[model samples]
Target: MAGSRRGSRSSKKTADRKDKNSLLGRWLRRLIVAGVVVGLLGALALGTAVYFAERSLPSYSALMNSENGQTIVMRARDGTEIVSLGPSYGEWLYSDEIPQVMKDAMVSVEDRRFYSHIGVDPLGLLRAVWVAVRDDQRAEATSTITQQLARNIFLNSNRTMDRKLREAVLAMALEWKFSKDQILELYLNKVYFGGGAYGIDSASRKFFSHSARQLSTGEAAIIAGLVKAPSRYAPSADVNAAVARANVVLSQMRKYGALRADEAASVDVSAVKLKKESGGNSIRYFTDWALPQLDTLLADSDSREPIQVWTTIDIAKQKSATAAIKANAPKGAQGALVSLDRDGAVLAMVGGTDYVESNYNRAVSAVRQPGSAWKLFVYLAALEAGYTPDDRVVDEPTTIGNWSPHNSGGSYAGEIDVRSAFAYSKNTVAAQLGNDVGFGTVASMARRMGITTPISTYPSMVLGTSEVRVIDMARAFGEISAGGESVEPYGITKVETAKGRVLYRREPQRGHQLVPDYVAAGITDLLQTAVATGTGRAAQIGRPVAGKTGTTNSSKDGWFVGFSSGITTAVWMGRDDAKPVAGLYGGTAPARAFASYMRYAVKDRPVEQFDTDLQLPQWQLEPDDEYFYGDPNDYYFIDEQGNLVEPSGGADNGTKSPFPPERQEQSPADQPRRPSRDNETDDSAPSAASDDFLERAIGGSLENGSTRSNRPQQRSPSSESEMDTGRSWRSNPPEGIIERPD
Candidate 1:
């Protein structure tokens, strides 16, 4: 028993000594860790100081310099202002413009200790760090009003230690440079409230269409709410977000003793109406007229500088042009109107009937087949290829490659002069000419005149087979009207820095001559004749006018391209989905639009003929005695250059029926036109004796007032014994969905 007690005592002594050694080791380890931590903290502090000392100083002279940049102002030739643009249409104002509620709301939400903080708020930094460290989440509330102001005006929003140090440095500099009230004023004026509006005044006017001097508590609260996230809190834009933001601002105001709790609660959140209206509301014309040129001219620079866009666009011309489209286009239809000066300056472009409602910019963006409009290009090529206006060409069934083109009327005319062929918009004649001219030459000529597109030498190019934009067509027509000056259409005149430093200016130089002056004149003469008596007769105005009507196969596209001395206008109406409009014709729709536009575009502009020297091809002359004795309205059709000529008479036209021979042929170009299904002509006439009269008309070549072939066997309107001929019925879209596509 005595030995056992002694062993236990010895074990206890050994255990105590080991415990002491362990305590000593722990103390030494803790001392080493503490030293390392101290050293690291010292190193970090020194490095931070050195980094800031070596940093480059900020230069805010660009912001301080008050040389206002050039403002883009669109005007008419007479200096009538159409639109104006500024740096968001804003100039900073201080307490004078801000209301009491706005000031209170701003201070309440942004900074509770705005007046007491010295550029660096140690307490705020500590709170931010603590939140960031807790559960290792990012800190959210680290900035003060002064810090935010520094970043909003002079610094970019970035996350880096250097940026934070810069913010601290700038805030300190601002504190030393300005008083609290002055700082507040600058901050208030500088903070952004979107909608392209910078200052409170602009924002106020944009939202309410009124000045900031007048604001109610609810309006002020909503305006102040935008400070958190301007784009997100736009009232009319995000209704729920705006309400939430307003409530937060209102809550802050109450907490800051700027408002009573119950008073804030009593306010109607719905009363926060946005000062800025939504949508591409106004300035649609600016975008429409400027974007295309901008896409081409703004080679390297982003669209950030204020600019001066000196344009030939006349506001009155555009308004009148748009009015015409609306009055003529079917409801829900889309339309494009493009007008240019004789010098090739685009005078007016209404991309849509109303630019504000749609922003697709159809005038410049849409590329569609010109239908018969392509025929004019073909005619121009043929006329240039030694073909005379009175020269006869077979209008019978013809095949170019695999595609066989038919006249709007199913049956073909044997022969017709060049003038009468185009006046009647003969598709088969155009195809025949297109095959002879080589589509490549026509495409080249079109390119020189500013028709930028990939032109295939396909036979269809004769009938406007190539697809092109309305703007491009307008540019080409402008070239013809300009007598081949080769003008490049431009919109922006200059762009400058905010300090009035010139950044850019548009100077379009004349490139190449497209066509001889005389060639243009002769063509214009034929176009005038067409307008006066042919398909485009509906496009005539009280003044001298020239135009061409284009109705594509199946009436899928309709166009009326015309020109006056001061402006060349083109109107196109169609469905966006490529559907046909039943019973619609270029003469009926787009031509009417052209006439309506001319009613106003011709104001104060002189009627001038295109100065061309080339003589026209042999045209059937209506002798002075004959032309004078008959009604002036009987034969002449106005041309693009505002002239007139007589149409060609084939065997059919030789037989006078008051209407021209081709008048019975005009319709959709897909299939030959015939009597309506209900009144369709049969294999036989109303009587056998009538066949004798038909034989006389169909005796020899069509030019000799005869048909040598079985032409009438195809779709002769005189036939009788009826049977189903497998004709398909085509219809246009609903009225509202139709837009004029010429």
Candidate 2:
């Protein structure tokens, strides 16, 4: 009975074992089928992705002809290349034509298994994945040359899985369609090397100023290093960083046995020479200013070929202007200058002291208080009001509303002629003139003189409180230089393709007369006097120069805008933060820079004298004397017929002056009081009075003075708002008025 029971147990155990084995086999078979299904699905997904990616790929011909970006080469008026705006390209080179060292350097650094891989390196990919998984990091890219070429030709730089998949598929297609040498040749010709350069040939020529065939081992390594980060490793951007990267490439080459360790060590990175333009980066300012105009000129056209822009910039003058600013710009202060012809073609521009330090163009983009330079429009308005340069105006302390302007030194000439007042930059005279002519008339005059900035009709706006651009000042002065015609500043003269087919050519347009010829002559006469004997005396270069000096409150901005020999130039100096500079005045640094620049700019041009038929009052002062101190020979006394007459007695004669007997040798109490020096204020500060004060003050004087019967007749204002219903101020009229004699 025991034997039979044991047999039964054995049989049950055998059945249980069989059941366990069958269950194991079923699970194994299911797992195998599941793995097969997943593999097939992955294959189908990859196949579908590749099919779409392949269909979207560009044609082989397109790949060969691809460009990184449009190249716009800018040339000066003399046909010298100033700068290249877009990516520069060189002639395409085949595989054999490329230097072997360059090819070897690229292969060793970018991909060691480039020759062994079909399209992608499975070993490299697996190693990258294993390392990533083991180190818990992102997978490293292991792209072959074929993959890089594919990406450069047909793909944007996006790192998504979809993009990666497409990149791999296109890479495989490239490998299948072309041989390794062909693929390498295409890659070499299509890669970007930064500094606005594309392709090995362009990179080689740009950096070394030679063809790729002449690349030494070190040069090859340097160029190869740029492939990873073109901007960071470009020699022009940072030479030391580029050299360090080249050493890494040399190490890779040594490891791959392409270069012997000794040869690699002997490579002198310092021997690599770099190409530099004549004017350096400073010329970029002119190119930058011209590029936008080029875009506008080509806006209506549909041509996409590489273009050549012939700009009006003179490279020689550009260099001179840059040097002038660099040498004369005060330390810790920035300066900008713009030069224009009478017809308004930009001759040269210096946006800042250094283009590399900062590219913020102050010449055309930055607007600041023009200081007394803005008085150009004020005096022009006065001229339009029929006031002669010799007309007598009080320079005594005057107030409009609650605003009282003062002279630079707080010294007032009790009663002065208009020419001396303007030449000396008397704030009181400017304020009175703006009020007399109406602020609206002043603004209109500015607009007509090529000032596009919005002008406020504020009482202080007459003293250049409103912000204005340097280029606008140049254009305004250019209008005066052009003899009353409107001036429109322009840079680009022509645009054409590389094949010389003209796409856009600037057509000459006749400038409409913005100001009357007599008005232009009158203003020019005053400007010339200002430069000859006034605050702008430092800007004189032994030629007829017409300009004005301007300094804002606390010396925040200094300016000198002048014209000579048919050229108008404007120079400005100030801190970017609008902080006051110590001892800065428009007649000092700005005038010096103007003189320095104009000396070189006008050296080649013939001397031309101003054409004006208006006779000016003679007022002579010693060269050393800056202010008029009541010279008898320089005085113009009013005659019995109300016409101006020179002092007949001269300094030696003690003859009675031709003036009202009560006005001769008046005491301080009888004249307008000068403002206290300690309480002096900037002329640009707006009055604390009501906003309508400027409008009400127009065509009137706020001073207490008696009108003389011999006073010159005031011309009617341009509009109804500027009607003169108030009497002119003549406070304590001197026995004789100072004036410049012709």
Candidate 3:
């Protein structure tokens, strides 16, 4: 009975201890739950306070569409900044205009979860905090694209707790107010792009010399990579570092499937040509000349805000031309240069030696005597008057209306073809030809070609006595370069407002034919010969070139007007006071300048041959002339004018065909005659007379007025029927042939 009572007391004590332990555990769990609830409420209250605090800071309505400033930027054909008026505000672009590769690069490298995030990313923030603590980096940033835009345009950038809160709050507000594309557009245009560029357009022009819309993938990568540290990886500052950054962006793009592996590998970082930003003021003669025309170009527009002007000025060619003139011209003598494309777009223009010292535009305004350069118009008139290049004209001393023009140094070749006369620049022969063709006709021809200056119809005018601007000469030569189409030289292409509104635009007008194709071809050959072997030989560039050399009576002015298939340029060197330079001749200083500029200008262009064929038998051959003979074996083809044609095929190289085939040794009676019908009248029957037969065979007419189309006609030898219909073979030469060579 005692043992049983002791067991019962022990069991009661154990059960009481267990019940106390269970109650203690329940109280501990309730206290832990209450602490967690308080912590949650505190966090929610802090976030609410931060959101409202940022909401009261500033309004973003005015800053949304506001332009940075008003400015009129001028850009070259390649979108290089030539100059800017007022403050620099670069070109603006819509979000869609930015390349997809560029957009993808930005998203993949900058904010990978940009599209999915609601302005603030909590996971990214936690990762960023962990990384900062683990790596001991105080400058770590986890802001999304929206957060960046907020910091850039709305709030100031600072690495403080309060600033971070404000940035996050504003970013959330921006997310609610704008779409993803609008937010991205704001970010792209607002971010600093180094080199004083604030937007993608400005950055593109500053570094790549192109618009943002035209940026290549490599170029876009380089620009997008600049956002990390603009000054650190600026292409102009260090191209290698910029390229390295671009490769990183490209790799990130590939990792995100925004770009293919093959695309990333094929991108050539070296091929991204960057225009180095230059210091010091550029010569502004071209801008100064183009600026005055704004009134006329924008006459219809009423907006007076600053407008961007897109011009055809090639900065590379402009600098080359300026350097050429500065290096070749004499110390005190002023020089001017004008370069144009075949379509009459002004590629380069240097009005004076120093535009800061003198704004007087010599290339456009100064009208000086062209000297022998003016003889081109006289010769063109002679060609229009039915004179062949092979027709002989006397270079002897000739007196015309009390004016006896003599060749330079009293030297004259007694009898020479018009080609030789022009090549050698014989003044006497030119004056005689001018008188023969009538000075009025030459003046009219000059006006028709491109010379707008008033010309005096006199014998001295043939020697370039009339004053002409350098640009006019370039335009006339540009027509020749384009194979006979007249072009009006223009600089400014169009003007646009800051918002991309078209203020004014130039419409392309079709040019008219000033010189016939055959006449232009003949002139080109003669000019090419002049450049190859004549006085302008100093201007040879080891390529086919056509040019002329001009020196006035007292050496007061020297001019060299030349053209290739790509460009036409005119260089003039003279003193401002019209005083003579000691030894200035067109072939010396002017030609040297022309060659110096042309060598650099055409270095990147392909070597194109001239438009005309050099081996055609345009000249009548004398029996004793052995140097100008054609191939003796070519017998199957003939050109339109009954001259032997040289086919571009077969074993025969560039050799011309012999004038007459050896098979024509039989007498007239021995030759085969065509059969005639007995019922036909004598006039209707084919003629037996040599003159009539030759005329009938070639389809001759007294006054043929065939005009060549703008496109070049095919001259292949296989089109015999076509050639036979439009050909003319003169039984006797024209009236002005002086036959004897002295």
Computed on alpha carbons, the lDDT of every model, listed in order, comes to: 0.65, 0.79, 0.75
What tens-digit string does per-residue lDDT give for candidate 3 at 624-727? 12133356443333333443344432323444533232222223334333212113232442222223223434677423433222211112223677455423
**lDDT of model 2 at residue 538?**
85
Candidate 3 at residue 438, lDDT?
Answer: 87
Q: Write the per-residue lDDT of candidate 2 for residues 470-570, one digit (tens) a residue.
A: 99999999998988898889998889999999999989979998877777888888888778777888899989999999999888898999999999999
Which tens-of-lDDT digit does each residue in 1-742 have in candidate 1? 8899999999999999889999999999999999999999976875565455334333434333332222455445555656665457455666666787878877888776777887667787788789889959987656777787778765666688888877877776666656787667666666677645666767778776777777677777777889778767876456777788888888989988999988898988786555444544223654545744654665676544555455566667766877888888866577888887766666677777654345556788788878777666776676666555545466677877799987665655465456666766777777777766677877776776678877777777777867889988777766666665576666555545556666567565756767766556656766765676567878888766767888887777888887776578888988778788776678888898888888788877777764434553333111210223344344433222212224432223343223222111111332222222112333322221122333443443334542232322222223333322211100121112112322
Minimal lDDT window, size 10, model 3 = 733-742
Per-candidate TM-score against the hidden true structure: 0.53, 0.57, 0.51
User: What TM-score does prediction 3 earn?
Assistant: 0.51
What is the alpha-carbon lDDT of model 1 when measured against the actual structure? 0.65
Clashing residue pairs, candidate 2? 617-740, 617-741, 618-740, 618-741, 619-740, 619-741
**lDDT of the structure predicted as candidate 2:** 0.79
Clashes of 1: 45
Candidate 3 stretches with Cα past 4 Å from truth are: 1-70, 87-282, 613-742
Give the Å shift of residue 510 in candidate 3.
1.3
